[model samples]
Target: MIGSTSWVIPGTYYENALLLEGLVDFVELLVYTWDEDTKTLLFNEMDKLLQLDLSYTVHLPMDRLDNVIRAYNFFEEARFPVINYVLHPIKGWRRTLGEKVALENLKELIEPHNRMVFDVGHHFLGKKFPAHLKEAIVEIHAMGVIDGRDHLPLDRETAAFIKGFMGDLITENVLINFEVFDLEDLKNSLKVWSDTFVE
Candidate 1:
């Protein structure tokens, strides 16, 4: 399934979700923080969001595990159509979170069989893309690391690599999120993906 980061236009999570409705298969909510205000908004907009097309996947907080637990609980209780939560591998939470979360690669390549949200930009920055991790991949954060920065649009330098790698990486079960923030980058990446991979 094709996905994009919720930061695409920067109005509100629900606003973006509504805007992205039908544009992609899912929208990965960039939940870097879990607060009462966020909770209230989600609660109020839950019904409206549920009525929209497409599913959801959340990018949980990269730091604290408590926030992760809190965020997941809300979505869980709502029975939201969240594909899976993408998290930077935290310590020992796997036992608790179980299959609900996909550990993303960062400083280390996590052990396989625990589902993963493979970030192409992360590996590109480090210049390592191991085939072994593919076995664990359930979702992909597809963006390019350009000029020492990650999450840039898929430019020519990275398009060839993305096409080459994704050709083998994509599958019926895997979700590919463009993961770009700017509208222009998202448009470009979507086009590049279609041009290079889809047709």
Candidate 2:
């Protein structure tokens, strides 16, 4: 079951995601805002999302590290059946929250009901984690940044590297979000992925 994000599907038709229910496996809902006041404003949208029959894996806000716990608490209180809680290995506070400390925090914070979203793009950005951390991963935000720009689809060499790195997880059916923001790039990347992995 392949999936894509809500932002790329063309139009302000987020709720119309149900239309693609047959065509796609799931819709990744991006929750980029996690402030308490903003969450109050977003309550209706959250309610609407919770009601959807579609599966979801939320992209937690990465603007600041402070919002991390709040975002997790919000989902916990809402009781949404989120497939995984996606977060970047944020390097912003690496002086204080180095990879080891950060991963330990995540291990302690996340409840058993939810798994983690591994962002290999951030890993490329110097936010490295131990290979053992793969145990907590259920979804992968799979893209590699070559230059400064991100969300770029993986080239053949990079894709091959990722396939070898991921190894058993792919065979285990762990969800992979291509992380391409544009529709055309997403389609092209899907074709590349199918050729390499699916086909």
Candidate 3:
């Protein structure tokens, strides 16, 4: 089951509710810089939104370790087996946060519950991304350029770079999420993957 990291559309929880009721087998709840009150409300709502007994993956709040710890505690208390924990280096305003600090904080915060979802976008943004961080994270989600320009939708150059980096850096058992918007973009991404990996 292909799980999407982003489910929330800004100012539209009803739309999110409608989408969640459909045929999605798995989901990674992308919490935005976790607030205790917000997390509690969302967790309660998720129980109602999903039709089947759903499996959960969490995109942890990267800003504060407290938020991450709260999420871990919530998952443990709820007995939800988190498939992965998606990590981002920076918190807000695209501010540069060192990867060493990020990784160190993550290790201290995360328990032995699930895998890590390392975002390539953040890695590139962070000036101090470490080689050892790759070893630490379980899965990698490659966020292609999202400039909303039709002609430059995750263009070949970026895809090739990510492909080459993934080939070299990623170890076995790491899953990759190609974050794309719309059907046309998805098609373009698939073609790139096919051309790069097959024939």
The candidate that achieves the highest lDDT relative to the unseen native structure: 1
Q: What is the per-residue lDDT of model 1 for residues 54-125, given as tens digits with 9 covering 90 to 100?
A: 788888876687887888888888888788888876765675365678878774555455587778878877
lDDT of each: 0.79, 0.60, 0.50
Candidate number with the higher TM-score (1 or 3): 1
RMSD of each candidate? 1.9, 6.3, 7.2
Flag the better candidate by lDDT, 1 or 3. 1
Task: For model 3, give the 10-residue run with minimal summed lDDT.
Answer: 96-105
Show where candidate 2 strays beyond 4 Å.
Answer: 9-23, 35-42, 45-53, 64-66, 88-116, 127-129
TM-score of 3: 0.60
Could you tell which candidate, 2 or 3, scores higher by TM-score? 2
- Candidate 3 clashes between residue pairs 3 or more apart in a chain or in different chains: none
TM-score of each: 0.90, 0.67, 0.60
What lDDT tens digits, residue by residue, belong to model 3 across residues 113-194? 1233555555444442344554555565544654422222356666677667656555445554445434355446556655
Q: How do the residues 41-95 of candidate 2 rate in per-residue lDDT, one tens digit apiece?
A: 4465666655656677666666776676567667667876666556654544332
Q: Is candidate 1 or candidate 2 better by lDDT?
A: 1
Backbone clashes (count) for model 3:
0
Q: What is the lDDT of residue 54 in candidate 1?
A: 72
TM-score computed on alpha carbons, candidate 1 = 0.90
